[model samples]
Target: MNITIYDVAREAGVSMATVSRVVNGNPNVKPVTRKKVLEVIDRLGYRPNAVARGLASKKTTTVGVIIPDISNIFYAELARGIEDIATMYKYNIILSNSDQNAEKEIHLIHTMLGKQVDGLVFMGGQISQEHIEEFEHSSVPVVLASAIEPTGKIPSVNIDYRQAAADAVAMLTDAGHTDIAFVASPLKDTINQHVLSGYYEALEAAGIEKKDELVIEGDYTYDSGIEAWSRLQELSSPPTAVFVNNDEMAVGVIHGAQDNGVHIPDELEVISFDSSRLALMVRPQLTSVVQPLYDIGAVAMRLLTKYMNKEKVETPIVVLPHHIEKRGSTK
Candidate 1:
């Protein structure tokens, strides 16, 4: 026979409602009572019938998570935070990867919605009009994690990319490096566009004219960073300092420069975005912009929960704080 909530409640000398509250992670129950109820649950091996509960509550207690690349450390960290928060709320997640492809993303959205997920947490580089239409029409609440919608009509959690990029470039400028280069992500990405804007804004503020050649487009990969450095070397006068879009590419640039006997910081100051573990693994650690990846995911999921539960939300569009982490790569 399957152990039921009644058996656990009776064993713990509490009402079924108390057991239900404890099982559902409700905070209103007293600590001692919660502990006793949990112990009874563990001792009795009481398992809540999720299907029956869903039928009664009209909730599947599941959420959909769409990410760009799960293998990438950046997205992996964000997914970790999202999963943790979801577990606390007793919600299971159906995660899918879109590989930053627009068509695949739309398909995944439709597939997840078909499953009747209570909510969705989406992370991607670009949000086109078609994407916005799908999200707007979604029966369930949708939240963008570390992604942006130009119209600000959709709820999202992210740091200020433009400001963060400008700050990183400003650091290089403050060091008196007039010819600073930028290794950027795909230009089509809205986040990359903001970063590029910041790069130009910082240069303009420093009384330095923008050079089209200095802004090298990258695919946000280590190989692309290496290729970017090679292309920079061919320039008439290469930049003295470089700001890369991500840690992987930043590492590639550093290695490429080192392979050619160029000293870091002293000879070629380098700073990159995304202060992930990869920053410290390199010879000369990367000076990078610290984006709170996990917090962005956690907050996004939490925001989705608020919407799912119909809770009052004062701020739907959340922008987390960002800062530069000084390391050996910069002077």
Candidate 2:
């Protein structure tokens, strides 16, 4: 078992705060008490730096990063930013993919914490009550990147997902497209739910009634986008435009339409979230909501450092800015 400051404090019959002062050479501690704490720390082979390294000029601690899917371009970009910032801070990161599985995610949390990571940065689609509880009870600070916990108890960084989705759908509405379709991801996660809510809100604002047939759910994959197109064509009156939840699926929708001899931006307008590289790779480049993936990860890692250092954070929950990037996919 890895010994921690808590162990040293318990053995010394002192508070963790008192043990901290002794470790940091604070003059406020009584000399006899400090000597006793030091003895306990030495006997227990406790390394204070692992728990409290805020005063150190050079940090060599490791932080854990939990990503839903590192293979996805969206999460890959976010991870890149996190890695760069971790390098700059002289800290290493242990990255794990949960595959969006609740049990696996919970397991990873316990395993990483057992390793005594100085902090944690998590990115996932769903944040369950159990996940929040684990994070709250964690010995190390936890920071969320592009994830939401409804209780707002955990520190996190994200853009206004609802507003961003609304903005994307509104663009299609502004183009006088009333017969619009939404290619959405699974609504199990709050993020996708926010996107779906925005889509409906935009239609309502444009005085268009929500059509049950016009909405199709995708699995955030290119293949799913293709499959969604097949479903939409089965409708008697196919939508004239589509708002996709992510760029990969949007590209699939575009290709699927083109394969059926449909002219993009002329026959069907398309807009998607996550202006990732996939957006620009297509023939008629995708118009997308700029989510600032890298920035979100970088900011999240920076925020984690603040908590690890016990620094005062003015805003524990950070909301970044987002905008629409119009391209050939949208008229």
Q: TM-score: which candidate is best?
A: 1
C-alpha TM-score for every candidate: 0.86, 0.83
List model 1 lDDT by residue over 60-91, tens digit each. Answer: 89899999999998999999989999999989
lDDT of 2 by residue, 62-152 (tens): 8999999999999999999999999998778999999999999999999888767889999889999999999999988999999998999
TM-score of predicted structure 1: 0.86
Candidate 1 to native Cα RMSD, angstroms = 5.0
lDDT of 1: 0.93
lDDT of 1 at 142: 97
Which segments of model 2 are wrong by more than 4 Å?
1-60
